[model samples]
Target: MKMKLIDRFGKRLLYGSVLTALSAVLSVYVYAQDGKAGIQEANDKVRGYFSVGCDLMYAVGAILGLIGAVRVYQKWSNGHPDTGSTAAAWFGSCVFLVIVATVLRSFFGIQQ
Candidate 1:
């Protein structure tokens, strides 16, 4: 059988959710280990404000991914195709990057 839109969207959402969750966990773990030492160092090295901006962007992406996942679930349950799955996936990627950046920040003391 051909894959349905809902199925594809659901899969994307699932992947996105998993990535976001992992990122969050990693960020927290690194933070606990060094108390944002990495973040501070990274910031000092970069000598710019882009890192902070990216962090905010990535957080927004995560939230958007979550919303997309919810929308996908609703569409699947109702036997409809979710139109926003692509957007969700993209946002999820952003979230993943954000998490990575944050963890890196904590690890390298960029934000401290």
Candidate 2:
């Protein structure tokens, strides 16, 4: 009968809508996480690596210093007129690296 068909169609539509809404709610619950926990985890991870990062910066600075010393030595031995300026520039770069690392470490309150 036409009336029976209409009733069946209406029921199907209503059931489909309910099911869709339920699935959406369930998906949201499944995917949702504690935002504070996520942020704390990220913070802890960065803090843990902070010391290592600072150490790496120090190592880089040391390497640069050594290289600079060698270059300065070579220039001086060759009687280059700009040798003093070159030495000063290299020394400045090494010092700048050290200062930057120290500043960042202290600024972030990172431990030794």
**Candidate maximizing lDDT:** 2
Stretches of model 1 off by over 4 angstroms after superposition: 1-46, 82-112
Provide the lowest-lDDT 10-residue window in model 1: 81-90
Give the per-residue lDDT of model 2 (tens digit) for 1-112: 9999999999999999999999999887776667778788899999999999989989999999999999999999999999999999999998998999999999999878
Full-model lDDT, candidate 2: 0.94
Candidate 2 to native Cα RMSD, angstroms: 9.2
RMSD of each: 22.6, 9.2
| Candidate 2: 10-residue stretch with minimal lDDT | 29-38
Q: What's the count of clashing pairs in each model shown?
A: 19, 0
TM-score of each: 0.35, 0.69
